[model samples]
Target: MAQETANSQENSNDLGTITVEAEALSIVTEGTESYRAPLTSTATRLDLTPRETPQSVSAVTQAQIEDFNLDTINDALESTPGVTVERVETDRTYYSSRGFEISNLQVDGLRLPMPYNNVHGDIDTAVYDRIEVVRGATGLMSGSGNPAATVNFIRKRPTDSPQASVSGTLGSWDRRRLELDVSGPLDDEGRVRGRLVAAGLDTDSYLDRLHRERGVLYGVLEADLTDSTQLALGHTWQNNNTDSNMWGALPLYDSAGSPTNYDRSTSPAPDWSYWDGETHRSFVELTQRLSDNWSIKGTVTHLDMLSDTKLFYIGTVPDASTGRIPNSFYLSKFDRHLEQWVADIHAKGNIEAFGRTHQLVLGSDWSQSRVQQSSLYAAATEDLPPLDEWDGSYPEPEFGDPDFVHDVTFKERSLYSAGKLDLANRWTAVVGARLSWLDHVGEQYGSSQDTTLDNELTPYAGLIYDVTDQASLYASYTEIFNPQTATDRNGDFLDPIEGTSYEVGIKADVFDGGADAALALFRTEQNNVAQLVGNIGGRDVYEGADGITSEGVDVTLAGELTPGWQASVGYTYLEIEDAEGEATNTYIPRNMVRATTSYRPASLDALKVGARVRWQDDIERERDFDDSKTRQEAYALVDLMASYDINENLTASLNLNNVTDEKYLTSLKWDQGFYGAPRHVMANLTWRY
Candidate 1:
């Protein structure tokens, strides 16, 4: 097996435990710094092998997020596999892969700028230390969108011995958390190294009177002057806050739409309606090395977010004589602001062309973003009555009659470049492109042809074939372009929306190296798409002709097939079509499945056990107000976890989520209706130094 991966990278570079240290490399020993190795043994963003990247890549480690005690990042993307995360309120969250919606995000690998409203609730996964996902259409290396997946987030560096760790958690609604991480060598010939991480969280949510608080800080610095030159610097900061948050979603019936049963603590807004939010982020990066195969890297980032809201929606006849109670409209204030910037430059090497070794990459990227929104509306009174639940002690309504005031702005800019060519020794190829420009403006206080501008060009390509060395076969093509910021059915402004995706895959690393598998088939097409030409004061305005297509097949499996056992699985099968004009073919069931398993018992080396299961199938919407409405049904869920390790720096954990508290419905919105988070329990403790 290629001499067992070259004797496992020469026993991880002569047992220096994968020495890292590189700022220009002065390390005389410790495996002699072979370009700071360790990117999980090749596959560093597609140099291939993770059974040859091509697509559908998943890696989530920090020991699988502390062996599944998974402290958010949406619980480590639920152990990834065609991901789906929808928390749409409680600080809003929505993620989907394969079924769309997942605007490629990246951290260490750059890219990040998505949040056009719907205040992402401050994405906190406790400052990441690992998390990677790449599924379908990564526009070569992420530039545009939709083939659904791309996650990437890796941070945590600085090592040379001195280590420190701390963790604490208590879950289920009144959650609490604390985290700290520290790392070694700041001098003393260690060529300067450092690391720090911090986190704090406080929660009290599960709907009905929500609450949240968050914080994160990170720092890293590394230096090594000669022997090939090296220097690194890093910084990160984050903050999040939320108070009684909720905005739409949670009303699945009754206005004659049928199916309605209430009581999930029913809260269609009324304790005065107030939702608040805040977010801030900063980042920086640099890496260099000019010889022995070459290298260079740089990154800069900044982000700011703010939101203030007062939402209340629930208009479906709740009393004008009982018509099934559901009337309470209000939006008396909503504000938003977002800003982002990004820059990148890169180069990597390894040559020897047609004769053998080849591995090259070149990159360039620049990004910009700005978005602002201001809104105000009010006009609902029939002697008040619309606070069925959500009791975060309300008290803030009062806007008797004034309705209409709006302002909006959005801007985007981009320039991108990418390349990869491995060839020789199993072929690999990738190419990328992106160039975008967009602007939008909207004003209403009596509107007057607002403003808009658009431009686009997104492209990507991929190919990989290693039919042996543990199997591989792949193919990809991608593109996406979006524009048109609201206002249509005659209000003008709507165009720019194009999408395409095609993928094929087969990857393997089964029972010989233990486990890893993949099988994929995909097809996606979207053109202009934007239907809905009705409601205009109750929201929902669309016009831009439609065209949609989705086809899918995905299957995945992961890791350790024996010794102490471990497993992961995912399955998806989807077929959706709605080709414009008369709403043609539509078959929506986007089948989904998930599985997880774990066990540790090599003569009891600190106990462990795990289990998880998930299933989906049941989504039928024929909108335009009905075609036999059915939204979210078909469900299955299970989870369990356990851990214990009392030596080498403490450990204790337990988790059980939705362990059959199945009242499903992870998301739905035509004005709220999101549930899922029933049975819950969490406990954790860790200390390491």
Candidate 2:
């Protein structure tokens, strides 16, 4: 849908060109309808525009979400530059950046842990105003993670004036979607504001017998108390349920290690198979402004997740000539519940140091989680079908009591502080550190384990030199901490993996800050990483190696080009090697590119058109059941969009994805994988008030 810019830009040289004082709209992108972000705080916890930050940052705005029809978290991050979305299963996904997996996700700057180090459900993006990504280790602001990247979701907030929108979508594969969003003040004096968003989707898939249903609801209330203090409370809920969901993808090769050229729609899932997930989150925050430039905030949050799945897997390879394929007969059913709670307090302000004003932030946070899971396996009642003649028609299994159960608890507490100092007229420096303590206790599959690590410290430092009003040069060093559960050959738990990152870059606010550009060179290292040894008594032992090293170059640009033209583009070049100096993480592409742009012509005032192009180099993975490797060649995809205003309060839009119909595997992370969706089309109609 065509949207109007919420904020205006007046001059090119003024650093304080736009003023946003309210905490609710501190870094607002709700109604901006543009890709360029005015401010970001993910890297430092201090409000700073993207140009002023030392690290590489990127954003997917509401406009991009609307234009590209980014329905799920996977779709949004998949198009993001420098990010790789790995779809290992129908409902599970893993994201990576800079050749390492992203370990955490944040909502409104608060970390929310995931289940099993993977995304379980299809997270809808309708309630979010924008998504921001900060590349590299962020130990100062974020508690702990890899050196890949951090994703922070910005929720849509109540507007000063009342507004509402309703939209419906229809697409290929009998897909349908509906959404409603509204925001306004709660009282005549506008002291209290409220906002609510809801959406639902039901869709069939290109893969046979795969169907999905998803729903989302979010609501928030903000109250201004005593003119200087503010209180806000919010809740969000989402559910994803799918039928005929495959436990794994179609077999990539036959019994002889030769590639199996199965049709893209082929699948091994039975009609009775399903995977369902639900998540609930509630949060409350209180903020107090002490002065014109100083503020303090405290927050508490709780999250709950539940999952149920009935899955089937066929690991044995097929024999095309003999039609003598032997499918695994053991099916499984799982039920899991995870709960987490977190609390944090932070203060940010300006201080006069060394005769110049500087920025500082201090914070402390605590989190704990409890997880319980159980599973049961059922033997196949009957099986008599060849690969060529098999459909998703099968009888449901009669599952008995759970035969395996696990219970675990994890706790972490941390304290962090950071400061940005003005060293000279053209130079600046940022320094920070974090101290954390972690504890884990669990009983898993009849094994008892307990681990603790205390006083873990990670440091961060950066220097920036202003080359001109529009450009700056910078270098930074950061580190992250990750505890391991693997055991060494001596039956001793290994130490935590320590990730260190080094980077140098240049940033420019070109076109008078209408557009932004950045170029960065980065390298990262991990130590004490686990390496496997021979198994003993059905238990695999491991050894700690020096781990791996990744180095890369990244370039990004995003902003309004002209009157009605906007573009966001990025390119990445990466190389990763292990201790032996051989290529590693070969499943991740070494070269990737993402480019998108949109334009609204003055002559065609009511029309807007846009396109997005994505390209990646070849990627390969060594098969687990065999020594052979599965490889997917380089390919490109093209997606197109167009929108037209039918009236003052109505708009119509259409999106076409994979227009070239390029066939490619979703990922090679596992020996079995499926192809991506084919050329698809969708149309949307929205009404606003």
Candidate 3:
């Protein structure tokens, strides 16, 4: 029996496919830039191959992650097509897709809530094996969110055989990094297994007086209770510390509405300013097999985050001659504790019905999350030192004890079910629905308010037809619901935003699944979208827009283009409009294209080289009440990378990003322009045993 089990494991590993519960726990994907992902449960809650599902899905494989040096989630998302990354501040970044913000994130198919205004999205990639992205609404899996996209992270697991590796990196701007990973069997018969990963980063930014330190640790253990049952437990911890972080961007325009030119290294933060954030997560999963064709799995997770900062808030357009600007100095601290419990059980099998064989899945899930948050701030608005030359030197001001600000709480409970069936001929069908209940409360020093939403159901449906052996056409419709925290003019919580999305696409696997291509057209309609109306009684009042619509076309081709070359290319065109037929969400580009390709020559044998390019069209922004408008011209950035294998165990790589050093602004909001990174060069060395 042991020998048979060992053979089964070896076969599964070689194919990168899971054959049993144990095999699912420790399978690694191979290939540097492959577009073919065999299995993903993020879209349907059932482990179906990517092409078999009627939705658009993309997997950023482990080989691609390492080849691109995607050290953080931000880096990975920036490289992904049909997605836009906006850097709000030094430590905060936001991602959007299809003209809407992406607010849903999952780990191992478990949905987790992340705050947009906090540091939760700045996750490190050391603990993850792959990132799966599903474009369009994933309402059946994610309880409440916009119809943008869902990103699922798959964590690394212990391997059947012992494996160890170490890596070091040196980069521009005083950047240094080190990482270690080890995984193997922990006991006889390989019933128990363990894995550990640790990494540290110390980097100085291109901006003046800005430096950062980051640390990450992840550990996991898996045990086989029986031949058909398994259990796994894991935890991840990450912390980030920064010195001299800016609260906002440099001045966009002077008092005369003329654009200001400042050095790329210019920053408004003083030397004494700092920000720190920490996150910890723990999770458990279990899998049981009842029959040869039937199996079930369950997972639970807990997450906590804390943050603190002292900043010199820069405000007001500066004088072009004197360079004097208004400054507000303050110290703030925030503590957010979230406890989430989720339970799910499902059975899958093939049954003969009506003279045909069909795959059926029946499952139900229940989840509840509670968040408790509080914050305090100490401020001094008067007697600030300024009206001088632009420099990184400033005197620290005395601050008293922080005052009580507010206390807030939020909760969500959801139940969902989904299924997939093979219809007659080459046609397939998928259907699912979810019911959710949400509640929230906020107490501001002495005032409090409560809001609730009960029993809302979101539905999903899709149809697919296999046109040929290598091509399939599909169409899907999905819905989404998201509650808003913004208040109306009456001081009452605004109604939840409701969205419906329609998508039609064709996917093809070429070269015996060595490459994949997809073309999709989508339209999304959103109602009750909250928009800031004005300030009433010193409080902001928001009103819902009548409707917003986003229509777009996306084309992607990835995997091996030829025998010795791999490439991924994507293009996107989007149009968004409000109820009045006026353009909306103009910050996001209307036309964008990205391409990445790598080549390993048959002659060199040990040398590999690659190049990447990203281009976006011009974007225009118009204020709600003003006639003045701002426009960011179109631009393209280029990158290059090369690697040389010294031996079977040693490898060296070099990467140069922003080769042209383009000075275009990546984000322009409220008259402030955030410049993109100028240029970066990173070199890495790795050894394996």
Candidate 4:
């Protein structure tokens, strides 16, 4: 959406002089709304507007979440641009950006480690107000990760005025959802406040006999110890359970290496297969303001996560005509528990430079995690049932207790500092560095192992020039390192992976700062990446690659165009090559686009309508087993939504996703393929007070 301005001109010969004025809003005194979340703290731990920060950043705000009816983090990320998603099974998903998997995550400025295989990718978004993403390396703040991107979740806080909202939803596949949120002052002076949020969901999937149940609860308390000091404590919990979940994707080919197109509703999971997960988190934060431009903050967090599953593994594809699948008849049980502690302390202030003001921040952080896991697998001697027409039902096996397997611990500590200096009239410089240390230990089956990585420094630097009142040009360089756990053929861990990133871009705020836009070009090079190799004697091995390179361009636009219209659009183009100069990671699209817009007519006052669309180029993958390549054709999906206000406190809404019911593959890897979801419809009613 674009705002229009009218210009008037008068002839001085026939009349007096005429004057004209610009209609754009001034940045000095403008306030941002929910639809236009211009300010973010993800870039440098400072509250700077997106245009002012020397990086490419994007945000999905509360308004956008409500408009699109996004219920989980996976949904939100799938809708975000420059990000790619792959589904391994019904409950397992992975995300990547710019040809690299995303692994860095933060909550309220504190880093939180991501689980292996993404068992927690289905986190509910009800406890968060906004999700911010910064594209490029973030080693200055996160310490270690890929050069892809960093994601930060901003939690909802207590409000000064008493407010409450409740919503109920009914959708396709017997889906049901309910949510409640309340926040207000706990005392008359508003010095003390509290907030609570809760949600429950029960949904059946398009895959036969597959279903999920989830529940979440979050609560927080904020108190003002003094006028310039604040203390906050909060806790969040989530429990998720799945029934008849598939362990992996359906087969993609038969014995003849020809395609076997499985129906979208087909699943090979046994009736008794299940997976369950639970998480608990507690955090405390304190902020002390030494002066108007100086402050100190400290935060501590604790997290406990547990997961358990029982599944049946299928190893062979059935004959297309027989409708019978051969199985190894193995029953497996697995359990994992993780406990983590994280803490950070920092101080930031303005400093006097060469006749100008500058900014500086110094921080230190420590994190530790302990993980325990156990598993058991038993092979059946008897032949499995065969010749049965494929259905989502099978008899449960009798596999009793199993033995304990593994225990592991990991620790990390770091110190970091960053500064922004006014180099000249229209130029600024940003410099930062981080020093980190890592330690890990593992014990399994009466064997012990330990690894330590020490004294690694990551550096960051950037340059910015203000070209105009509402536009800026910037360039930056950053470095990152990641430790690998994969072992080589000799059963020894591989060396850490290293990467460097370079970026240049221009960002602008237009239409009186009512809209924002950015264009960026970036390149990244990585070394010592782990590549899969053949398995030997029931053990898998990997070998380190010499190097890989990725280059890409990104364009983004967002904000309010006029009085009642809002829109967002983004496009990405990326290419990756291996050390042999061959195309790699072909599962990710080389080009993609995402756009959404909403409008509310002034005459209709209480009604709103919107639409969304996603398009991607063709994707190709090569099977390592058969040395055959397959390609998925280009495709697009459309979604529509509308809402009406019944009164000041009540509203009703409807969302129809995948309107055309397009059947397409979302991911292709190894010898398996995954199908995208079909058409879905959701209707909701909400009440506010």
Candidate 5:
């Protein structure tokens, strides 16, 4: 997992009979020096290029990351098509794709459910070689849940030769960042290799009194026990501390159900409010070559995350005449810790039957996670000072004993298998199924409850037909099941929610095979979805929905457009409806486009310039308090960058974001909302060897 093992580095646009004697090492795109990668294993268990895979897949390569300065996961996802990053608060976020939440994330094919808050603070990209997103039901590889999308983060590995680089950046709002990366052979025989990556950032925000500090580190070592066997160990750590963290966003409506006009920098946090987070992960992997056509890889990983927060909350619309809002105000302090362990083992190989070769993959995985938390709360001593008069100059609450405690554990195990067979001339079939067992047991808020489910099966099927040497037509169907904690009217747990996805499309190797293009029509159907039935014993009961649907169209093009030029562009149109045929999740935009392009002229080979544009249609969220919807109009943002090689080893670049200074709310998912970032600029310099 930390060294390259293959026949050799293959060109990105080349396509032919695909074989994988190099699966032991996986695919590495570190030094490819291209905006596009040639191979990926995230869409399917087999090693195939984006075009060869029967799904809508997208990749952000190392070159694109560096050139675009996408230093954080949020920054990268914002550039991906058919995806949405909702910043509901200062430190918490939610990601949605194809009208559903992305519930899990993977690293090198190892899966972990999303953290308690989905995402917090920052996830540095320095440790990753590339990030791949498989849009649609990836149940064939990922066990269950979320028919939206699957994200795979490929970690960087040691290089066959010594390499070193250092970089520094200064940006708007007193932002400063430094990063380092180095990799090399650890022994004279080149049988051992190592890589190290680290980054540090300190920054203030466009919001008043908000500040953040972050640090990250990643390390990996690989050793070859035998010529055909290898072992690798790796660990990663990151810490984030924020001052004046906003627990909740600003109020959107006033006493008269009219919108409130607050400056973009307006904040709801007190002077002493804070949020801090830490994450630690360690992994070990072993790969063995059973034969020239067969190989096995086993992996074990542990993840731990901690968050300590003390914050404030405000609710209800303010009164217009009294100068004092009748809203409820409160303060609370809580600390949470979560831990997870995951293990996976798999074997893949090729076989000959009927004078043709076919690929088969078999694997099993198990995972367990537990979360513990304690909280302290106090209602505001009095109504919060008038909204317009408040300046965060208020008395601190004298907190009492623990208000609540939570301890819960969840476990899931599954066995999955898939095969790619040559059905006939210019035809191929991909089919697979997974059987999973899941359970949740523990005391949550002092309530002891246990739930379990077994023998849940998910199936996957797909077919591809070669329309021409440069084009292919394909269709696929996939299913995923999500276990439920919700109870029925009889106090019995309901069955798992089921999601089935269908897609048909055409993919082509265009621009003389230097690029790839695809157009897909996709639809998803969900049943047994939870819905509010009625209140029983002063508690709301839920019943399954008959059916819910989401359908959309997607078009994308990516790769080298010409000599010294690269581009990636995507567009999407989506609609979601419930059993009654009424629109659902209206907050999700129906139309979106993400495009970026860079050019390095032949006359000025040492200089590069690029631009990016992101646009989305109008979206709205219903406000029960106002009896209306808080609507945000369509908006578009543009960014530009340029870099110049000062010498053989030094390079300088500058990036300007939100060139139009578009002003809009970050989200309206909740009754409260906040504004997005304003215009900003970042300058960076690097030295490499």
Candidate 6:
């Protein structure tokens, strides 16, 4: 039936161009039509276009990555509109969109489990061809989750032709890196192909006694088992080691509320403190073309993570003489392990029914994860440790004591289906739903029992209308439900969190060339959100107390507006409020803007120069008790890149970040203070064969 529908569509196209053609109206054929097709036609089976996807979607392609010299996943995503990246440590990072943290991550369209604050290593952008982002509630595709957004990393595939590349980089703070990528056919019949990527980096931080070393290895193999069957196997390994890692932000103000800045060279950790982490992932996928228009795919993945660290947290102590001013104390030691497994099956096909064409997708996902931690505390120390201790110049000291161990396990299962119907020549509609179940168990080595289960259903709907051949308008509504794993006073798990989002937008190929642009207005509401009322020592205890609402507008322009010159611009206007808390009407910035432009003046055949700027409006935060008292601030950053191609196979590039050397914070909190990164420069040389 699906094959018949596809044939009918092809037949209609042929007939319209021949027998039914009218001289009054001419069908315009653009040479670049194939280039403008949805991304699904490019190495993946998912049809996602900015205009047809029913949500705000953004794609960062390989050209953009190379133009910006993006080395990591976080670096590549920083240029995306409505997205923010914050580095917590050398190896840990956080991402948020529209005032909410994004938890849904996908590799090749398969959802991966994201435990609380867990960062996975399988998302390295160095081995990917592109990155796709879908904003707003993704329940139709992600099952149970927050209403933030979803990030999909598309891996690089082996081309029919053989290619290889090697790059070396040197940067500020004595940083050095080397990377290699190679791809070719593995069989004479061209039935088997493979690609391999590897990189190593060593760098020193601006802060005293801080340094890091990291490496990654990735490989993918594809085999055509038969005329209609294919299989792929992939593996990734990453290791990171850091000395004197920073955990908390630095203080931004003195006791009198006067602005204060810490020296960029200051280090919060003792010279003896260090952190080391290792991660490994293995994945396999099978694809079968059951028919011309119907296909099924299955995937399985496993992940392992381990970390060992000695951390220090600064504390205040009373002075012996004045008894007013306070001295400082530090607490430090820890080991952690995380393991996960995920499996999924997906089926997609096309059907003709109700006098229209419909695209249907059905899938099921199963995931399991386990997390364990063991921590030790250090006794009070009066004597300071020497900075050179980290370099093996000083003897080690025993300052800590042993502590207890904790373990937690999380399990999730989901079933979902979605469909898009082409109702008319210019109208389309999409509807979908998901059913999910989750279970959690927390056990203390010698404590009481804890276990719980949660289940929920989520739904989505959207509509799109083509106002013209070059423009389209769309509206969508989506919802999400996330289960809570924390136990209540009665030792019972809390109910799941729920949220909904509404969005309307217009998308256009403005120049009728390869250029694309979009403008969207969105509003989201979250209910039963957890809020912290008090703290048990250093840990925060939260209860489901209040609701929150956010409204925003997002604008983006990308691709080539003209030949030899390319530009990308993004802007967001947002309003966030606490609907049910004492701190209502608190505004979260509301304005953000970013722009990038590159030009190759034709006269300079081998030279290309680019510049980018980002700005954000002031964010106002008021005290819960005294609404009149507040803090407000804004920031802007600039970066530049230039590259020279010596030949078809050789290129050299230079990058300058924070060109103005501005001192500003990326994130701030009253309790944790402020976090920021300093100005830096990096240079790279690449050779391709």
For all candidates, what are the clash counts?
Answer: 16, 0, 0, 1, 0, 0
Better of 1 and 2 by lDDT: 2
Model 5, 1-689: lDDT tens per residue? 43342324321111121122444125566655466666677766777666667888887877778887899888888888788888889988888888888876888867776634278777889999888888888877777777888888888877767778999999999999999998877888777888899999999998878899999999998777776777889999999999988887888877777777678887888888999999999999887877778878899999999999988888676776664666387688988999999999999899999999998899999999898988899777667665556776656787788888888898989999888888899898888898999888987787654779898899988899989998999999988777676788998878988888999999999888888899999998888988888999987789987666899998998888898898888999999988899998888899999887899999999999999888999999888776788888999999999999999899999999999999988877777888988999999999988
Off by over 4 Å in 5: 2-25, 115-117, 321-327, 382-390, 443-449, 534-541
| Clash pairs (backbone) in predicted model 2 | none
Between candidates 2 and 4, the one scoring higher on lDDT is 2
Model 4 is weakest, by summed lDDT over 10 consecutive residues, at 14-23
Q: Compared with the true structure, what per-residue lDDT tens digits does model 1 show for residues 72-144? A: 6876786677777766666667676765677777776676756532226655665665676776556545555
Clashing pairs in 3: none
Candidate 1 residue runs with Cα over 4 Å from true position: 1-44, 47-87, 97-122, 125-147, 156-185, 188-192, 197-210, 217-248, 252-320, 323-357, 360-385, 388-548, 551-689
1-689 per-residue lDDT for model 4 (tens digits): 00111211101110011110000110101112235556665767655677767777877767678888888887777667788777767777777788887878888767776645354427898898767788877877776778778787777766656878999999999999999999877887777878899999999988878899999999998777776677779999999899988777676765556676777877767778888999999999887767767778788999998989887766775555554556655577878899999999988778896799887888899998888888777664433333233555566666666666788787889998887888998898888888999887887554554667788899988898999988899998988888787788898888788878898999999767778899999988888888888787777789888677889998988888877787777899998888898999888899989777788889996998988888889988886446787778889988899999999899999999999998888776445666787999999999988
**lDDT computed for candidate 5:** 0.82
lDDT of 2 by residue, 377-470 (tens): 8877655365446787777788898998999888889998888889999898888898999898997787765779899998989999999998
Candidate 4: segments with Cα more than 4 A from true spot: 1-33, 115-117, 380-389, 400-404, 443-449, 485-495, 530-545
**How high a TM-score does candidate 6 get?**
0.86
The alpha-carbon deviation from the true structure for residue 353 of candidate 3, after best TM-score superposition, in angstroms, is 2.7
TM-score each candidate: 0.32, 0.95, 0.91, 0.90, 0.95, 0.86
Q: Which TM-score value belongs to model 3?
A: 0.91
Q: Which residue pairs overlap in candidate 6's backbone?
A: none
Order of candidates by TM-score, top first?
5, 2, 3, 4, 6, 1
Tens-digit per-residue lDDT, 1-689, candidate 3 = 01112222221321112234332223345323453355677876766665677777776666666777879887777767788777767777767788888888888777777544234435788888778788787787877888888888878877667778899999999999999988778886777878899999999988888899999999998777777777889999999998987676666665566566667777777788787888888888777766766667667777776667666766566655555654544444454555556655666666677777666566666655555555555554543233234566666666555465455566676767666677878888888788888776776455564669999898989898999988989999998888876799899988889988899999888766778888999998889988899999898899988677899998987778777687777898999888889898898999988777788898996888888788999987763323666778899999889988899789899999999999877675445556777989999998876
Best by lDDT: 2
- Order of candidates by lDDT, top first? 2, 5, 4, 3, 6, 1
